[model samples]
Target: MTDCLFCRIVAGELPATVVLDTEHLFAFRDISPQAPTHVIIVPKAHYANAVELAQAAPALTGELIAAAGDVAKQDGIDSYRLVFNTGADAGQTVFHAHLHVIGGKPLGPSGLDLH
Candidate 1:
């Protein structure tokens, strides 16, 4: 976990455009924006993926969702997309559990094509 990117970000060892930071969660603007309002919400404590995070800390998982919602509201986004890429095949490059909150424009009918 010490080498994890999100963990470093949470520890303030890396620079990120932080949008929200709480006791258990950290939300920041994605370096590579997929949408006009793209943010990545990550748990302060590292987990390999969504399933692991949920299994180990359900409450923190909920807080992640809540933080994402709060971000959407703060961004004034009426409709947004939440995405979790669990593995390498699923486009999860970071290897740390995180949520992608994308919106601020017509995101289209399907969210699958997003990467």
Candidate 2:
């Protein structure tokens, strides 16, 4: 986990535009944001993905999700997307467990894409 980028971010070893932070979770803007307000929520403790998180820390998992909701409301997004890419097949570039809170404007042809 030493090489995990999110872990570094959580540890303050890397820099990110942090929006929120709790005892166990951290939320920051994604460098390659999919939406106008794309934030990534991550746990301070490292885990590979949702499956791992569900097993290792179920209570914190709920807390992280609740935190995401708080962030969404604060960001002025009435309807947003919470995405958890499970693995490489699901477009998960970062190995650590995280949730993407995407909203604000449309993208792609239909104005619904995040790219």
Best by TM-score: 1
Per-residue CA lDDT of candidate 2, range 1-115, in tens? 7799999998889999999998999999998887888999999899999899999899999998898889989899877778788978777888899998888875434333322
Query: Per-residue CA lDDT of candidate 1, range 13-85, in tens?
Result: 9999999999888999988797889999999888999999999999889889988889999999979999999
User: Candidate 2: misplaced stretches above 4 Å?
Assistant: 106-115
Clashes in candidate 1: how many? 0
User: Model 1 — which ten-residue stretch has the worst lDDT?
Assistant: 106-115
How far residue 81's Cα lies from its native spot in candidate 1, in Å, is 0.2
Candidate 1 — which residues are off by over 4 angstroms? 111-115
State every prediction's TM-score relative to the real structure.
0.93, 0.89
Task: Check candidate 1 and list the clashing pairs.
Answer: none
Q: What is the lDDT, from 0 to 100, of the residue 90 in candidate 2?
A: 74
